[model samples]
Target: MAAVSKYLTAKNSAAAGGILLVLYFLKQRRRSAALNRKKGSANDLNSEKDGKKERAAVDKLFFVRISRIIGIMVPRLLCKETWYLFLIAVMLVTRTYCDVWMIQNGTMIESAIIGRSTKGFKKYLFNFITAMPVIALVNNFLKLGLNELKLCFRVRLTKHLYDEYLNLKKIITGHYVDHLHNFIFFRFSMGMVDSIIAKYFATVVGYLVVSRPFLDLSHPRHLSSSHAELLEDYYQSGRMLLRMSQALGRIVLAGREMTRLSGFTARITELMRVLKELNSGKYERTMVSHSEKDVSEKLTLVPGSGRIINVDHIIKFDHTPLATPNGDVLIRDMCFEVKSGTNVLVCGPNGCGKSSLFRVLGELWPLFGGSLTKPERGKLFYVPQRPYMTLGSLRDQVIYPDTHEDQKKKGISDQVLKEYLDNVQLGHILEREGSWDVVQDWMDVLSGGEKQRMAMARLFYHKPQFAILDECTSAVSVDVEDYIYSHCRKVGITLFTVSHRKSLWKHHEFYLHMDGRGNYEFKPITTETVEFGS
Candidate 1:
């Protein structure tokens, strides 16, 4: 949890830091903009205004920076004991220098046995050098291996960042998922690993360079107790001291930077809490009432078997409920029934409450005046007029709601999937790399008409009985639309369609209509002797 706190705090610091960076960049841009405007006009007045804004932006940036340090980086330092060991290993392995130290030293013979004279030691030293590097490498490499143990330390911040990334990729909806994934997966993990490896390797090289001076000698025969050698030793010792000082300074700075990051994390968390208040306070609510008073509440009584999804009594746009001002709900009395194997068409006109009705039914919005009954959350599939596609293999697109193993269990093979794609005219596109679950800027690749067809392919793959398609096939050609619908019909799928293409109306046997007066009348357009093109 401390690691999570650390991660959050770090993220917070980054966010705060970003705010600073943005403000600085904006200030610079504005200054330039003002200068440009001033260059032709009166400079004094505009300059004063630009100066004021720049100063304000600078002040905010400074405060945000300070907040990042306190909120993010400080907490990391507080809990860094867990991670210090690995970093220390990185330091130790990087600084090892026995080989470099031995490179220039006096006669190889003396080194083999400490008391032997410098020239006599040469033979043994030659033998030792060949075998010693192996032991030295192993010993030093083992110390570096200690780096693996560091992963065991588990920084709270790193884990939290990962969790946030995971939850985002797995559960959260809307735009931020892709953006956050890019940052956490690429920037934090791979980027940090690269930077760290480079610095440590540089330190290792430095050790090799620094150790070279120790081997330089004056008059090799008189290895000890000689004035010339002593002076030379003194010069080399001074150089070593200077190099060590420089290395020490660098270590201090690295430590300080880590501290800064830690502190920045703390300040970031402090500020971030304001943003994360929504997430950290997740409270699972138990449905309180077994029975609902109004149709709205009644909708809740069914206990949706597919997903324990939340349904609200009011749908608000900005703070106002999207309803008729007369307390006549744009969606007055409504019950949403989505059973598996049902296809629902959500239809209405330019503000006749069709999209609003689907929005309410799909659980995206609240029923302004009714309660909703739903199955398990995430079970019901909603295909909008313009469906969203991700960048992935073509396989991913066809197998969306990817969690449901039943499709595979039912022996829905590649052949079956391809047949479905061909029905929707997407079979040709499948051969394109990554077309299976292609997450391209597909919004661009496929024309508006093709996108709707692709949505149908997604719908067919999931085969969720209960689907609310709100003009989902709007842009498709009438024939393609007929093919998709006819396929659904052959599959005996229950459907609720909302479309103005009167050609599509006969596809649904049951219909619910909402009047502009904010009251919905659910009547049986239902005919049991179901006939298509009726």
Candidate 2:
């Protein structure tokens, strides 16, 4: 119990220190800003205004922070399995009473020794020995209950954060789990500290009541006995000093821990505020066109289409007067359309809007002035330069975005999945890892080429209407790349691929070349175009 108390105290002190540091930093920044404003510079004033708004937002969230902390604690405590909480309360109450009784007995033993009374000493000593076993048993059980409570709190808090605020990727690590546990544990420790202080204070008060006669500053008019007086004086002085020292220590410790608690509340409040903003979509990027003229010259939205993708009178103008999400205009007055079951190869130099054009088509980047017609969301899929592999087995990797139920509904057999893997020449993975159920840290395990090939395998599984291969095959050899493209074509999946490889031109029917200097040319891939190599 003493070891546990010490550990909690250290953690509380550290939390208080963290809060202090954050507040200090914030104070320093405000002071610096004030000094700069006093210099009477317009630029300084403008910068100050921006910074002050952010600071004010943070300041205003203190109440919200407290609310968030309460939110983390209350629901879990009041939850269905609140029996754990009841058990903890009972344990704490038992532990507190036991502590007080032991302290009282200890004080009596001290007085007995000082008085040199053999009989009194033996009586207190027998009481102490008898209580020791029960106290030990209670302490052990209390510790066990406290640990279980911490685990319960951790699990609930983790669910809240993961399900509501943050995604799985950010909070998957053991470090994050420990962070959640510490947050709840600190509050529990504060209650323990309070109980300890109250017990000690009550003990000291009881001693003062009994020793009031000797502690009176005034000299006694009628003495009891000279020897009694000496003993009383000695006891009074020592007890007063010890109580004062203990009180001072408790006050300092409590104040420090409370400060840390405040700090923790501040940090958590800020996080909740951010999460709220994210949930409200307040931080989502605003899509603005390069030119006001371009915004006004909106192309008519094509009524509807069964085509895989369409680009109608798409004019990507220069971003001279204003900045766009895509830095500068690389393709000017670009216009093209890919009907159903047709592939277009987008070719451009570095910094040209090859990928940017695809982003616009995919509705990721803002369309400057054009009618971009595309199929529904699930109908289109993009294969980036780096494919993301989520934490799951190889089966999950193949039929991604599709749950096992969905796969079962579609009647997708393991044999079919293996064949898809075979298409990407990754059939060896099956034999090496034993089966499709084997899970691996694929990001570290797979080579760049292998990862891209795996991505291709995934594409084969989904087989969307159009797949934007954005340099997805750069690391892939020419033969494998050819095979992947051919396979997609055979699957009736129209492709809008961005690549610098000259070998890629033969796979598509037409070419859309971007000149980086706001000019574009589009035409069928001619026999003469086959000679050029990037």
Candidate 3:
């Protein structure tokens, strides 16, 4: 009777532990789900209509996205990742078997003590001691395999993303910016949820198992062989039940991990889809205007488009409408022509299509009306208001967009580059920064005026037939700017200058003026024109 009562007590304790574990896991899952819904609601409210549509698509095809991502990460059946996964599965099975053996051996140890059999106790204890190393080895090996698998997934996925993103055939600047924003936001939001759930589970599990009570052996009750055997069976069965509950809890946690993976899969799949569309020359953007008519039209490509022709030695735009990427038409009809050595000055109000015209000429924005004729790609160059500093040595600052080999192919040595720098009065930077090989964060290291001068040097190094100077020398002194202009004319390079400075009027042969109302005049630059314009 005592043995039966003790067996019942042990059985009840194990059942209670299992129940508590399950209840805790359930509570955590509910809490996580509630938090997710709250966050998702806030995101939906702040997101744009396009974002909402994308989210809907992602949710609707969650499983399909997961499969696509899995295909990318593990491309082949005979890959190393597959072998790692197989080994991990084997280790898991081995660990489960070891756990079962340890549980049974523990119950036997307890029985031996209860029956006062020293030989049985010593034998079972030896078995437990012998199995501990094997269990530890299996556990560690499983962890190593999992880490390796994760690394392989990351490497493969990153490589695939790079291939799509950096493909030269269909690169879109605005699309990349949008995709980056989505990637960051989704990862952060989903990663937070996973982190919170994992930490909560770990804390609860630690506290629950911190002071587990062993079998009550203070008062041993001897029993018949049958009762002892039956008691051992009961104890082992209870322990196995507790282990099963723990395993189920782990499975639930893994499901949470899968939820996070689904988020990642959605983001990656969306990126791939967008890239494919861009490669095919199809693009979509939210219309800035909220007109019902505009929404109804819903043009996939930029509306009212035109044609582009590549020619040599001249650039002409015949009735091209300057439009922004957001479908805001800046100018209805723009017509201008410039040949080699013809310098033109552009002046206008703040939003009056001064830069927009240049963007069309450069093919940065789509030509959205009449025909455009420009010199082949290498004959034209652009210098923006703010210059971009490449990541390389001082020599790279001058010979930008060209490698040392390219410079060598042109038979222009570093000494020639130095002369180009001197034309812009930046020759002393080599001695100041120690040598041509010295590299630093040039953007932060150089002042605004120095950066502008370096950009001019880069222009001189390239020496294209036509250069669009969009207020690029805003930070330079009038004297240095004049010298730069004289050097450009000396080199026979045509200029389309975008500036409102009175000092820049003398260098250009013609002036193109734009009013904010889309009216424009292209006329010769004279004393009357400059004074009247001022």
Which pairs of residues collide in candidate 3? Answer: none
lDDT agreement with native, every candidate: 0.52, 0.65, 0.75
Off by over 4 Å in 3: 1-60, 66-213, 218-275, 278-305, 531-534
TM-score of each: 0.42, 0.55, 0.63
* Candidate 3 lDDT tens digits, 251-357: 54576566677677777888888666644556655334232335464323343247878887788889876667666656666788888878999888888888878
- Enumerate clash totals for all models, in the order shown: 74, 1, 0
Scored by Cα lDDT, where does model 3 land? Answer: 0.75
- List runs of model 1 lying over 4 Å from the truth: 1-371, 383-394, 401-407, 430-455, 468-478, 489-534
Q: Rank the candidates by TM-score, best first.
A: 3, 2, 1
- In candidate 3, how many Å is residue 425 off? 0.6
What are the per-residue Cα lDDT tens digits for candidate 1 across 1-534? 223233333245436434643554565457646765666454455755564322222244555665653343335544554355556565565445543444334323333334445565665566666767665665666565565444533344455554443332101565688888786885576346434433554344344443343343432433565554444444454455445545544543353355345555455454445334323433122232222245444222111111223432221122112332112334324453444344434444466777664454454432232234554335456777878776655666666656326567867887888887898998778776544444566767778887788788877876654566677787887888888888876765456676666677656645556555544544444545322322
Q: 502, model 1: CA deviation in Å?
A: 9.3
lDDT of 2 by residue, 1-534 (tens): 333333333255446435644554566457646955665465456755654332332244655666776677557546733766677788889987886686667667776777787898999999999988998988888787778867876776667655554321111689999999998897788567555544564354435443444444342521554554466455555555465546544654654555456677766656666555544434333333333346544322111111223333222222211113323434435555566567888777786667666555554444434344557656778999999987888888888878778888988898999999999999999889998889999899889999999999999988788888888998999999999999998998888888778888889887777766556777888777653557
Ranking by lDDT: 3, 2, 1
Best prediction by lDDT: 3
How many clashing residue pairs are found in candidate 3?
0
- Candidate 2, run of 10 with poorest lDDT: 299-308
* Global Cα lDDT for candidate 1: 0.52
